[model samples]
Target: MRGSFRIEGHAIASEDGMIAAANGLMPDSLKFPSDQKLYEQALDQAAVIANGRLSYEGQLNSPRRKRLVLTRSVSGLAPDPKNPNARLWNPAGESLEAACAALGVTGGEIAVVGGPFVFSLFLGIGYDAFHLSHAPGVRLPGGVPVFHEQGSGRSPEDVLAAAGLKPGPVQRLDDGVTMVEWTRAA
Candidate 1:
């Protein structure tokens, strides 16, 4: 945990490592009821959700959670103009601790939901754990990857492992979907 907060990343991707299609939209092929159930349960436990604007807007239930929207438009941290329950944060200007303090977040899990950039950001910041769910046989050749470096030939698992995270047991969530939790190596 970093300063009383545990950071966790959550994402569902296609087998080819794509989280969204080329248009920056998650295709239905990657969505599974069981996977979403688990995802929602995790969000329910988070102190605050963090993500890029695209990731936030893609979720219908985003308004239900206290969140941090990563954006360069904000100088540091400011009340989110679109959602009263959120803050627009510019990591380049302010640290996550300062942003969390502004949001009145004392301590708990900071769930990092994402667009590729956001995911890549936390991978560098370090995650206590990352829950990755994948849909087999689904492939988005030119889609947005789970990590920006994936385009340079690194798989999501490769990226995570390189960041010092080790995968736990994989669990099948549905017919063609499976989930795994990767934790930071000791």
Candidate 2:
């Protein structure tokens, strides 16, 4: 089964290489009002692959949620055997390819909404598109950077470009935020 992958990153890129605050939580200042709607739309008809931390701390933790896969490096933690829509993956023991197979996910978009590590992982695997929303005039001084290499002096755009993604036209969102779509180069 051929699956398409896309990543969504919200808010301004931080100076530090972190997706959340030092406390591992997303702060209010960086959040945009429209992010919730965008996230809902992305998750509407697609399966979601998210980092373990995010899965637990974010909205994916809702007991009623379905079609969600959480990837973690730790052992002894597996997806509920009874829930076909939820899956737990140990990347160290199993390959992402294998995990996808077990999840029975095929032929639909997989939204990789992440922390930096998750984003970094998919960056190497490649993406069909990346939806990046930046909140203007906001900067996270000690907050995490959107890309892993951002701390190394490489911008997120540079990283995407290096991965063969081409930027599309910019679209405006609420509160001075701008969203850009980056698609893989043909």
Candidate 3:
């Protein structure tokens, strides 16, 4: 099966911990229609590659589908623990590819959902789909910059394209963020 977009990040949550974009953000219900569409896209992305964070272990955090939390430790997660499909783990690897190797995941189809560092790490290594939603040019004077680190290099799209992702449609969110979807070329 297509492993889907590869997103890898590190955070010292529980061994099986992970966090999703929706949880990290303010209510998406407050956003405008276009922006909401983007939010909905994120919510609808059946599989999300997230940073291992404690938030993912919530009884409520039980993923609707398969959600993986990649860590270097031996910790594990199970929303029900009883359900065989629901899983969590900490793999040994310094990079996503290495972890994917251990997990048997192909790693090409992943979207690279990031908390910061992961996005930066995978940007050029074959990053495909980028869903960035900001409050349309809205900036908090003292607020943190959204991306892991502002790229002093190529535009995200450029870097990823150079890495081998096929450019797809780019959708603008009424809020500051835009959804850039990319696919690996066949």
The best candidate by lDDT is: 1
lDDT per residue for candidate 1 within 1-186, as digits (tens), equals 258899999999998899999999988898888988888888988999999988863456768789999999989999988888899999999888888888888789999999888899898889999999999889998999999878677889999999999999999976668999999988
The top-ranked prediction according to TM-score is 1
Cα misplacement distance, residue 72 of candidate 3 (Å)? 5.3
Off-target runs (Cα >4 Å) in candidate 3 are 1-33, 42-48, 52-62, 70-108, 151-170, 173-186
- What is the TM-score (0 to 1) of candidate 2? 0.78
lDDT of 3: 0.41
lDDT of 3 by residue, 115-182 (tens): 44445555545444445433443323322223433445334445446656665575655444445555
lDDT measured at residue 160 in model 1 versus the true structure, 0 to 100: 92
Model 1 error, position 159 (Å) = 0.2
Model 1 lowest lDDT segment of ten: 56-65
**Residue-by-residue lDDT tens digits, candidate 2, 1-186:** 124444443334433334467666777665666755675666564555455455332455444444444445445236656566566765556655556656675435666667677677777777788777766666556666666767667767787788888999988877676777888778
In order of TM-score, best first, we have 1, 2, 3
Local accuracy by lDDT, each model: 0.89, 0.61, 0.41
Better of 1 and 3 by TM-score: 1
